[model samples]
Target: MKEFIDYLLKFGDLNEQQISCITANAVETELRKDAYFAEAGKVVRQTGFMTEGILRNYYYNSKGEEITKYFVEENNVVICKASFDNEIPATSYLQAVTDCRLIIFPKKNWEEISGTVMIWDSLMQKIISRALVRKVERISPLVSQDATTRYLEFLEHYPGLANRVPLSYIASYLGITQQSLSRIRKNIR
Candidate 1:
């Protein structure tokens, strides 16, 4: 939970009692590779802070193909913001790309912490703002870039991630076929 606390500290100040309450409300959990942290059409009951491994946010396209939207790696928050905040079914899925360790807070406990902590809402806002900016920075390039360029940019942006996740997922994120990604990888080598 130290990792999670450290991440929170980046956003706002927290006294020892506040930190203790936050920690007390959180539960440490593991998600196995290929497991869904939150599935499409289901209400997300918990929000998590990733301490290890990776998760892919994805959704099925009209043709029933999975399209990876974003990746959440260590030291990041993993939550379907709209769904969690509104208590609605999620439009996408958060799946473990690798076995993951996370500190999770159920909706009730999260609310309790928010109510008890003076700076909780402000801290969350800062974190969310940062996440939004990061998301835009990561995704905007893919819209105009060619497959090869997108792959290269992905590597540059998330070093070592290409090797850590399945090529199929990377291909999906790049909006290219796995075969094309393989060819790109081969040519780059």
Candidate 2:
């Protein structure tokens, strides 16, 4: 809990009481592998911090294939920001890739905290900025690179995600077929 508070403090200084309230009041949950943190069409009422394990955000296409959008590892914040920010039904699914421990807060609680705490407002702003940066970085390959080049860039960005996540999922995240990814791997070697 102190660790969580310390991370929050980086955005802005918070009163000790505010920090205590945020930590003590937030819900702590544990989820098993394949469990969903949130799903499409559900109203996402909570925002969370991933304290352990891995999670992924994905959406399904008309054909029912999952398209991976973002993966969050331990110590990162995990929220469907589009739903959370707009108070609408979620368009993406949030799933646990491994057994996970999470600290979560209701959207109402988040709103109340931001109203009274400058630190909370600053934290929200920082999160929004980071999300935008991540989206821009994800689009870089489409403009300047071919499939093989994009595969290399993916490795450069994530280093060892191939070992950590399923190859098919990584391929989907890269917007390429698994066969194409296999060909790229052979070409690299």
Best by lDDT: 1
| Best by the TM-score measure | 1
Question: How do the residues 1-189 of candidate 2 rate in per-residue lDDT, one tens digit apiece?
Answer: 655677676677788788766866688889899999989998888888888888888999999998988677776787888788887999988888878898888887787777766667677779668767976797677458888888787787767666777878778888889999999988899
Every model's TM-score:
0.98, 0.87
lDDT of each: 0.95, 0.81
lDDT of 1 by residue, 158-181 (tens): 888998999999999999999999
Q: List the residue pairs that clash in candidate 1.
A: none
Cα RMSD for candidate 2? 2.0
